[model samples]
Target chain A: MNSLFFYISEAVIGMKRSIVMMLISVITITISLFIFGVFLLISLNLNNIANSINSNLEIKVFLKETVTKTERSKFKQAILKLDHVKKVNYTSKNIAWKKFVKEYPHLNLDNLFENSPLPNSFTIGLDNNQYILNVVSNLKTFKSWVEKVSYGGIIAERMQKFSYYIKILGLILVIILTIATLFIVVNTIRLTIINRQNEINIMQLVGATNNFIKGPFIIEGILIGILGSLGAVIFLKIAYTFLIIKCNKILPYIPIVQNKLEINIILVSVILLGIILGILGALLSLSKALKRYSFNKVK
Target chain B: MIKLKNISKYYQSNSLILNNINLTINKGEFVYLVGPSGAGKSTILNLLLKIEEPTSGELFIDGVSLLRLKDSKIPYLRRNIGVIFQDFKLLPKRTVFENIAFALRFYNYSRSRIRRQVYQVLDLVGLTTKLDCYPTELSGGEQQRICIARAIVNNPQILLADEPTGSLDPETSWEIMTLLSKINMRDTTVIVATHNRGIVDDIRKRVISINKGAIARDEEQGSYNS
Candidate 1:
């Protein structure tokens, strides 16, 4: 126990000697993880927006204007009977005309025509928004002379492709940053080990074991890792908050909703990531340091 | 209490450092090892210190065979034997007090005890005022004295010093020799290895001479005749 205290004190002194190098390491790690954390936050928000769009998507089935009232009623009943159909609403020509005027109140549509020229349309809603593509394809087989069946699958497909690219880029960034962080940590700790090499040699001659010699260095690495991770977490929080506020203000056309639950989730994930990286960095450097130094052969 | 029977240590494929060495130093016995350069004077210290194993032989300390001991048990053996070197290998960054206190920490000494013992040893070596001085700030003689204080801080049963006065002048060397003699009188086996014929002739102690890695002379109250 007394030996452990001495070793810890020695580690602190060693770190103090290279305080500038230690700060550089911590800053590098924080920046790397911050980049990763910000990318994750953006991707998560994009995913949430895509989900909201999918839920509100509607499949529109236009009908032949020449159809009679009884045929339309039968067609509507058939759609409501379908297994996947959630709701069915038939828009008459008058109702469609009224909605068009409501959308363009200042356009003075009353001067254009005596009677409404808009055709009656059937707006379809599905039980599961994700299945709209398949649902629209099935609707095309209806016997009510379906003019056209259109769903938001095309836009959804494009968004999905974009999401794929974002994920790939995020992964690549993480790989590059992780390798760079490890390299930086390994080199810094290596310099530290070199500075104390003679002391280590003397300790070995005095019958210190491999564990005894390595304990201080490993502890130093761990401390650095922890501090770096904390810095990253702080940076992530600031970035996430800034993004949420800025995006909400700039992109008013697309409603941006910040889910408090998701923010909590990402915050927790970043904290855990910081801890894992800290421990990993320590363990990685220690393994390399031990290989270059053999306790029994110090003399 | 060290026993070496037919111990022979060789280097590479042909060169030998120690050949068929048989010797025993009883408990509380002080002995001086005198030899020219490359005569295995340090090799004998290295073997007893268990830094290297013998090529063929049996070595026992307190009836425990060092050659057969596991690596984990080596530290326990070393705790009983304090070692000092010719270079005064005190850590340059540490103070005189810290250097000595470091040895006691390994033995799990309490903080108060470590402080008291370190100061005691510093005073014994006449370095109480220089306790906070770094090795680089001290003279060659003072650094060597600090090394001696560090070696004896743990109160080991055996003290193995290799060419301790090799870098010191006549007066300082004699002072070191007197200190070792005083330490030996305290029932700690002190083995000093050196090539200083002047000190050998003056001390007239039990001297073991080595030539070409083999013992050539062993005499009580011996002087430098080679």
Candidate 2:
């Protein structure tokens, strides 16, 4: 156990002395993981925003001109009780007329019409945008006194399709970045291993097991990975803050700003990414160091 | 104890590197291997070290058949055999003290024990003053002495030196030979492979000569007659 600790300590010292290589490795890994983190953040928020918009796309159900106030109340209560329906809000003709007049008082509607021409309607919201299909199917059970049922069907479909594309694109980006990160880390560790060829031979001769010889290099690789991941996390936090400020300035009304919870998740994920990547780099380096070379026999 | 029986190592399906060789060296016996280049002098050392398997023979070092030994056991086998090379093979980046201390690390010796053994061996090689110096800063003879210090630090049962004085001058060569002789006197079986006729002739140790991948002569106290 003491020997293992000594070897690990020695390996760390060796990595420290070779600061240039260590820095380079850290920078490469950080950049790759930062890219991945940014994509993750954007993808998650995009999903949330998409779901919000879908739920708000409500159906407007128009009532018949001769329907009684009691009949309208019954219709409203029945729609609200439906499985998918979240809420039923009644918009009376007088309320609609008043809202129209408030927005456009100079349109001369008073002289053109004797009374409010619009029919009393129900604005029906579903629990989720996907529940629109179920709500539409249930509305078919309504009586002929219902004039029309209108919802943003085409718009909802388009937005859903767009969100799907974005998710797929994000997944592809993640895979590409992960692969690139592994490749860069592995190659960097391989160079370090090659540099220690003589040390490896001496260790082999000393009756050190393969694990004993590889443990240090593996630890070194992991350290490099951790440092790199840490760098990435720092970079990502700064980038996220800067991007949030920039987006707020550019499109303040778009609500693109992330909450504290979202930012915290990003931070945690980036740190975990660093640790995983570091372990991967160490594994790659260990396998290379584990390879035996014969000093007694000519290659 | 080391034993070789009908050991023949062939290459390219045409010629043997070591042909039907049979020999044994008891514990604490000093032996010298001398031959021309590519004459299987190094091959014999490699075989005994278990660095290469003999194609058609059985080898037993301390009653352990190296031929049937697992790959993982090779390092344990090597621990008992101290190897010295002409190139010194010292880690150039490390100080002389570190190089010697490293030999003990493989065996996981205690910290105080490593320090004592390293210092003792450095004193033995007369390199105690240059303990902090790296191999590149040391002279050729000094570097080779450090290699010797490293080999003996573990106090292995067998010391195998392959042309240890090949690059040194005649005076330095004699110094290294004398050091080997001294080490052998301490009861570790020593084997030196060399083409340096002057040093081999002067030593007058037991000699095994090889030519064209075969043992040409084996003498109890041979000279470089070939």
Candidate 3:
């Protein structure tokens, strides 16, 4: 006879025995994990925004459509010769049109142009991005061949710093929320133990082992934790997918996490953490209660 | 059989609960422990139950030295014994049937077997009609009967009743005593601790009287004062 099924059934019975308490526990975990996940999503998107802005910070020297290949090579070499210049990437007119089409497949450039009129451009990479303004100033000497010399302004740098602070602050808040979740879980389990103290004494009096006594409470913790995490995961999934679709329509260039697999992986990690903490909380509260409670009285 | 040899229990290292004691009760015996309040009648039961350690002695249950028993084996030890309390410790929320079925859980009995055994015990206690009644709904006598049904449902070899009739009237107490006597006739050893002099004298069983922390008298077929 497998006792596992029996014990698990006992845990289920216990859950139904006091549905209100169980609901309180589940709701607590759900709200906590949901808040934690919201912070996580915000931090991830902030990092994405910072990267997008940094990519735009590089100086772009758009060439006049009439420039020869030999002139392009000379211009690239001259740009590389500048202080703090790391490398130069050259994009042809046709390649730029293809890139634009890939980024916005819905927007047909053909409707706006008779042909691929996109200009060939050179992107300058610098060893230190703080020298972007200086490089942009140097490109002025070649105004005859250059259509435009543009780089992201001071706002890009500010956004990078802002996202960095958000990342650090998000980390601290996540740690605090995790601790709070554990404490709340532990307290909830402790309260359950107190409520069932009479039942526990009866169990002991009738020859139930310590493990048998602990089985249901541990199972309760796991169920509560899992439910909480799953609730948060489901909510995040629906809300995030909707937010991503809306953001894509309103702010098309903003890169938010829209990958289904990535989101599932994150949710799975959250559930695993919830389970581990649930078991820990159960064990901690149970040990204290069991030690305090002898056969019929609390010591 | 149960035995206590040179058993001494103390509290906080100085306040003695039970002084050097030696006692033994054979199988198929009905023994009464009678004394005044705080005479340590309950402490002896506590020691035998292993709820508290005998501070300085050897205690044995069914020929096994309880001192040498591993902590893990205590539950198994308890399985061989049943305890009935005065206050009728039944879960207020549970029906009489559920209360009896709870004791059979350690056996991992199937649902049919559990229901069958619970019915059998309830029949023996004569409360088969009140199976669905909760403790709160049952009369005091009926509640104690439910507790008895729960205790004996497992068919333990030894039964320990600590002031089992303390909360009952004389008639109900006699009725409970008659039921315990019926259980004892079926090869179960029954040890009852009580301060009720009327029940002790009328029952005419082996009586051990304690005063302060030591046994003051031990007699067979003893009345309350003999």
Candidate 4:
């Protein structure tokens, strides 16, 4: 439509008029988003580390000494068929005694053990950490043959709680920053409105609709928001790359978020959040500016 | 036709802008609203534009009551009535062509159509050569011409100019007045609010003089102070 192009061009011109204010808005948004992105990355890698460790914490199902070969084999098959069960390895009493002796080389257990008293055990690996508690509870149901089920109690829950807290704290801080950024954007738009008062008055006199007059301003906010998001993307990429490299060097064995695709996705979300913030700021300031514009100038 | 029946406006309880005023101007009639500063001449123009509603009164144009019109219809109502101001309110950064074409943005006119209309209005105001000049680049008279061109670009049935020649020299004032009169000849009702005694006397038209918030005189072939 004819009006769409006009709105875009006018928005561009308006920004050109108040370029400094626009830059300030962009910088403020970028800083806010960058800090927000840092928290997101931290939470993401924390989850990554927890996942690596949980996969290794397999459930050790110790079997009763009186269980027969057929029953033991059937129990192992049932565990393998469980929804979250990935793999199950059977260790006989002889193998368990040998592994225990190897782990504790200094102890003189030859006389105390008598005839290899260690029970046969089934080591069960699961597909995901979320299934650990449920699988442990399910293993306990085979009470006739199963003596005990242990999957490093309380550690998985503690890791989950810690990550959840980090995410919540990050969300709170980002919200505060977003609010502050919104105020800055509102202030910048106020200056733009004042700068373009003459044009607005002219538009009003020409019988232009309020939407037509306000279109450029809304577009200005969106543009500033988009620009700010791009700035954040660049800053996040550089800062994350540097931090990731340093983390790898300092804690090489620790798992973290190093994949390119995941980083890209987070950046995309930040961009979307920036645009939403921009629109909100624009709408907020516009209502205030327009409600009083004609009243003060045209009255 | 425009009609105001007992129109009154009050900014504050103690300060009444337009006191129980009544007037009528028919279609295609050229009229001058002559008054001293703060005599409520501008207020009358503002009321006609519905920029400010009357505190207590009725305004009718073409037999429709403006007070009864919804807020959403105000823009469409304004489309038929063009207004120019004393300060030649042209966008300073925009070229003369853009300044005139700006008014046509409300409608869905094509680019070429808008260009044609802008050129036509510029020619009508005898400033076709200054199409690309910015407002600052033009003289006082030329700037006012751009303002007029923008006002009439939409082919509005009524044009209200508040002190259109307030900042011009005597010759330039005559030039602007002549253009307005020429546009009036085309059957567009013209209402100019001014206190220029020279132009009012020289150009014979309906003049309405206001003292305070009430009409002091309304006469055909009226002068500045008669």
Candidate 5:
């Protein structure tokens, strides 16, 4: 306990001695973490939007005009039993025609045709978007009852491809940003170690053990990390909240992850990332410094 | 007790810092190592502190062989041996009290114990009045006294002083020598390496003179010269 206090005091003294350098390190860390937070927010929102669109996608199965009500009900029951099938709503030809006319008001259907051109169709909701291809293929196998099965095949394929690309791009960006942040942090810590060369020499000459000397330095590094993380979290919170308000005002239709739970998750992850990066930077620099100047050889 | 047998230190294939040095010093003895500049005086001190490994030889302090000692054990060995340099090597930012306290902190001493021990050493070195003064604020003699206080604060069994009074006036040099004698009286072996002929003559301690990296003369109650 006494040693811990001593280590902390020593670290504080070291920090005080190089206040400007320490501040620069902290600020650099803050900026890097903030950038990382921004990237995370963007990726999260893109994911949310993709998921919303996927959930709304529904498959339309058109039946033959001669199909009876009993056959249509049986078809609906079979679709409900299929994997990933959530809900099935049967639509009669009359109802389909009414919905079609309501969707396209310019077409005067009464003058164009006496009978409805639309066929009976069943609207199929799915538990998961990944099963869209499988369900579509399975519906095609029901050739006796289904006249046509369409789930916007081209659009669905394109959306899935786009979602995959977004994930890959987000991953690549995160890795690149994290590495850049680590490099900056390592360089900052190396500078701090260089500045304290004299102090470290004195400590070794006084017969301090390796751990005794390294404890304060490691603690100093951890403190820097925690402070940088705290700064990033505060900055990110304010910036994110402001961004949410501004985005809502400008683009009301854009879907974003604005819930408190999701924002908190992002905040926690950024703080954690900051801390890990800080520690790694400190360890790398400290080890390099230690190698350059062996504590066992004081002269 | 300290013993060195056939110690040889080489910087390169051709250059030797210390060559085939054999010596011993028992407990509670005051000894002076006298030699000219670059005559391996500092190298010997370095060897005692294990700051540099010998090209070849065995060194034993208090019956433990240092040749095979692990690097991790060096600090503990150093705690048993105090070292004083000509420059005083005091942390300029630390006060006299803190400078002395620095040695004890390595041993996991409680704050109260460290405070007590630091004050005790400060009083011994007659610097209790200047406990809070930084090294920059102290005179050369006072700074050297604080260095001595730091060296002895841990109650080390052996104290090695390498030209400790080299930077002081003759009077201040005498004062530092007298303090070292006082420390020696406490059953701590004292070894002072110096080029000062006057103090070496006046002290009349065991003097080992070295020339060309080897001991040239060893005398009892010897003067600076043969």
Candidate 6:
């Protein structure tokens, strides 16, 4: 307990001694972590939007009016059994006509077609867009019952592919940004260690153990990391709130993850990430310093 | 309490700094390592501290062979030995008391214990009133005194002073030597390396004179010359 107090006091004194350099280090860490947090937030919202769109996609299978009722029921059962198929809703010709007319107010069914020309159809909702082609091919195989099988094939496929690419790009970007942040933080701590070279030498010469000398430095690094992370998290929360409000006003159709609980989770994660980065940076620099200016090497 | 057997140190393959040296100093002995510059006085002290490993030799402090000791055990060995340098290597930013306390803190002594020990050392070095003064704020002699206080604060069995008064006047040199003698009287083995002929002649303690890298003379109640 006494040693713990000494280590903490030493770390505090060290921080005070190099206040300007430490401030620079903390600010650099804050900026780096904040930028990384922004990237994470963008990627998360993009994934959420893509998921919503995929869930809303549906395939329409038109049936021949001459098909028997038993065959129509079998077709519905087959679709429901297929992989990725979520649910199937059957619509009779008369209901389809009513829905069509409701969708297009100017259209008069009696004028457009002599007698309800709309055919019975099955609206197929799927769990995923990955099996869209397979489901379409399977529906087309039932030639006797299926008159036409149609889905937004080109658009849905493009959207799915785009979402996949976005995820990959987001991962790559986060990795690069994290590495860059680590580099900056490590260098900053290195400079702090170099500034305390003399003090370190004195401590070593006076019979201070390696752990005794390194404990305060590690604490200093952690403290700087926590301070930097706190600043970044606070700034990110405010910036994210502002961005969400602006985006809501400008593009309401864009589905964003706006749950208060989720936002809090992200903030907490950012703080944790900031701390981890700080510790990693400090460890890297301290090990380097130890290698270069070991206690035994002091003249 | 300190023993060296056939100690040899060489930076280059061909040139030796300390070659085939052997020496010993028992407990409570005050010995002066008298030599000219470059005669390997500092090298011998460095060897004892294990700062620079000897090319060949065995060093034993209280029967523990330093050469065979693990790297992790070096700090523990150093705790039993106190070293004072020619430049008075005190932390410039720390007060005199902190400088003394710095050594004790490394050993994880309680705060009260450290404070008590630091005060005791401060009083021993006759700087009890200068506890709060920084090294930069103190005179040359006073700074050396703080260095002494820091060195002996741990109550090390062996105190090695390498040119402790190399930068002080004759009177200050005598004062530092007197403090060292007082420490030696308390059964601490004190080894001072110096060419300060005045103090060497005045104190007339045991002297080991070195010329080149070998011992030229070893005498009891020895003076500056002969």
Candidate 3 local lDDT, A88-182, one digit each (tens) = 99998888887887888655555676567878999888899877778888997898899998877666667777777877886787678778887
Best by lDDT: 4
Q: Candidate 2 on B190-217: residue-level lDDT in tens?
A: 9988988998788888888888888889
lDDT of 4 by residue, B24-119 (tens): 999999999998899999988887777788899999988889899876677888899888888888888789998998889888898999999999
DockQ for each of the predicted structures, in order? 0.46, 0.47, 0.47, 0.47, 0.41, 0.49
Docking class of 4: acceptable
Which number leads on TM-score?
3
Better of 2 and 4 by TM-score: 4
Please tell me the TM-score of chain A for candidate 3.
0.77
Give the Å error, residue A263, model 4: 3.9
How far off is residue A226 in model 1, in Å?
2.1
Off by over 4 Å in 6: A55-57, A60-122, A125-131, A134-164, A260-262, A295-299
What TM-score against the true chain A does chain A of each candidate get?
Answer: 0.70, 0.67, 0.77, 0.69, 0.65, 0.66
User: TM-scores of the models, in the given order?
Assistant: 0.83, 0.81, 0.85, 0.83, 0.83, 0.83
TM-score of chain B of 2: 0.97
Q: What's the count of clashing pairs in each model shown?
A: 0, 0, 0, 0, 0, 0
Give the per-residue lDDT of model 3 (tens digit) for B1-226. Answer: 8999999888895887789989999999999998888888898887777778888889988779988888788889888889999998899878888888889887888889999999998999899999898899988899998999999998999999999999999999999999999999989999999988899988889999988899899999997886
lDDT of 2 by residue, A1-299 (tens): 98769867976775776667777778877887787777777766666666666666888888889889888888878888888787888998988887777755545466566688888888887777677878876776786658777886766566667767877887797778777777777767666677887787777776777777777777777777778777878887888789878876675534464788877787788778776876687686666456546543521
The residue-level lDDT of candidate 6 at B70 comes to 81
Total colliding residue pairs, candidate 2: 0
lDDT of 6 by residue, A1-299 (tens): 87778777877887787788788778877887787677667767766765666566779999987888988888888888888899999999988887777765533344576567888999998888778889899888889888998876665456667667766776686678668777877776677677788777777676777777788777777788789889989998899889888877777556678888877787787778777877788788888787566534433
lDDT of 6 at B153: 88
TM-score of predicted model 4? 0.83
Candidates 1 and 4 compared: the better one by DockQ is 4
lDDT of 5: 0.83
